[model samples]
Target: MNPPVPLAKLLPVPKDLTGRLALAGGGLFLGQWFLGDLLHVPGGGLGVLLTGAGVWWLSRGSTPPRFQEPASLQGWIARCREVLDQFETLEPDGGVRRQQLDAVVQRSGPQRLALVCVDPATCPQQGELEQALAGAAPLTLSVARPLASAEGARTWPTVLQEQELILFSLAAPLLAEDLLWIQQLPEDQPTWLLVRSTAGESDRHCSESLLAQLPARWVDRVLVQRPDGLLRDVLQPLRRQLGAPIRNLQDTRQRLLRGLHQQWQADLEQVRRRRFQALQQRTQWIVAASVLASPLPSLDLLAVAVANGLMLREMGTLWGTDLQPDVLREAAGQLARAALAQGVVEWSSQMLLGLAKLDGGSWLVAGTMQAISAAYLTRVVGRSMADWLALNAGVDALDLERLKREAPVLVAKAAEQERLDWGGFMKQSQQWLLHATS
Candidate 1:
């Protein structure tokens, strides 16, 4: 005979009774702190005592945790093996092999549930089948019936079809009340009903037809067996019960995940706003420093401004935000057209503003390709101004002239790099200028 498997290794005990008790006691103490001493209540001492009592009340249920052996998947494997060994004993030459059949059993609340069926039986493994029924957990061998009997095994199929609901027919006999206990459950709760009599007689039609009467969502799978020994169809009710709870839990988890995602998005937006503000402030400081060094004089500031706008196209590509290159190109074109119409040769803030308003310009342009490019130029101008201020506080006519001449070329290259539609950009620019001037 194979040696009995050790049960201790399969199940472990917990050992945190003291800590659990302390936590419970702490909660009570917190209540006293909140309600009595903090409020300067007359019965504060009484409240403290009551808090201690509350802790004691909670601790009454706290047992010192024991050190139990670890339970593993191997326990389930062993259980399966045990059922097989018992089956072979019942029928030495039984057509079924240990590998062919699987046994599953569940015990929850007051009922026992189990499943023992021929896995790949060409013919019924009658002897081993009887052994499986006999060896069910927590309930005695009841009955095994022939599958062919139309009125005999209807109840079996009604329960076994549920994929999630597990069953365990007990090794010990069950009373009628035990059968009624399981049968009385709402059709949605996965359950096992133990039958005591080994009699093969069962009202298959009644049991099966009654299953049809059950709510559609309540049924999963069912299994029926006679005391004599037989296989029945898989049941449906058990499956529904098993799947229902899991479905509800999944929905709850999904909602929690969505809420967390929204919170993360809000946090990211806040961080981005703070960083953008800091960058703007730092850029302004650099420009202030440059202006004190050498200032623009006798040069086309309007062209320089247009080139600065074009730089947005490059910054747009560098950063993945949808700061459009086309928009920046249009803005630059508008500045150029305004300069041309006004008989001005140089680009400047006033010339660009004449073409397009800058009222909400910072907000509208800051992240846009045009705005980013403008910001970059602002930085450069600021740095240059600071350097000039530090050197002599004098105007550099040559430097200003150089900036004006190079502005158009720089803007064109930036537009090309951004893949801007130059023709469309110019048209938009002209329209913008007309609106601005009007």
Candidate 2:
């Protein structure tokens, strides 16, 4: 890493814990004096503590402070790497992703797609539809019975090696529950729901309702079957939608490979996001608990530092970055400091109105407010740290100067986003308060 930015060049603000504490003490004194002397509020100590909490809460929105922009995208990523290197351990959960990627890479023969039918009774024969698109591949197509059958899952892989792809033609009406199950399939294959006409007023015409319940992303992947339309009529749009070649088995495999790779990447990203959220949530509550245990209930970074450091290390594990622990604490420290600078503690304490809604604002007893604020700050730090890890993946590391330049920007973005999501967070806090109180 490059030499740290010269102290003179740094922002002319409280840059150390001691200095900031001094500043906070000064603010508390001033507020106490204002409230007690000028405003004539009784109880000096109570007035001071309440004023301190109020000042921090009201001023929470004022920071994570902006900084000069990095020169380039790679530079920004590099800066993230530098900060992470000091505190992050690279260890991504790549085993599963690699196995899936290898499935795409090692397999040379036919690819597979699931053809689900909402009304099995009225669906056309699989061969007819295959024949309608004869030019799309070298005519070695076969249909599987049902995805619900004992042999359903192995059907695709165990198909003849000569076959380029075995389109699963499950001979069963896909119920809503089946739709839910299909979404969890590890194969993550593209599905085409065949919407045929009702089987002669047998109440099988509810394909529209089934289609609507699918996740919004899968809505357009349907193939509406008509009462009298030929199989060719069905093949026309399917081919166009997939941009399939009229003839060329090689081209078909390549197209399938590309689509598979894209889908697999999307699947991996979704997994990462979900896992990160789980980690953040777990870390936040842990920090909240620590805050409750600590004697000093005011906004102190100590409650979050250790827990957030572990969080950063785990996050690094998800990205396959092996970070050193001694150095990792430094990374968490940086983020914690950034969070405090951003007024996360005060921002979370802004729940004064929210507490009033919960049992006449009695939730402030025994430092409940501090515990929740600590949790909120932990969330902000973890979120910003996740972003840094994501961008730092596969990029070169940078100098200390660059990190100094970019760290605040990253934290600011996370703070702003968390602020927008405050409504949801407050609800979670409400539940936590009830649990703790109970």
Model number with the top TM-score:
2
> Candidate 1 lDDT, tens digit per residue, 1-438?
233222112211112667545544554564454334332223335445554444333223221212222133344334334434433433343634332322222212222233432212222344543444342223222222322324443244434323223343421233343334344443533444322223544546424543564434424333445545433322233333333453433332333233322343343334433443344334433332232221321111233333343334433322212323443343333223222222221122333434446455432221122222233344433222222212211112223223334433444343333234433433443454344336
lDDT at 350 for candidate 2? 53
Model 2, position 81, has a per-residue lDDT of 36
Question: Which stretches in model 2 have alpha-carbon errors above 4 Å?
Answer: 1-267, 295-301, 353-359, 396-401
lDDT of 2 by residue, 140-159 (tens): 34554444434443233332
Worst 10 residues of 2 by lDDT: 57-66
Q: Candidate 1: deviation at residue 157, Å?
A: 44
Decoy 2 TM-score against native: 0.43
- Candidate 1: Cα lDDT at 101: 25
Local distance difference test, each candidate: 0.34, 0.53
> C-alpha displacement of 173 in model 2, angstroms?
57
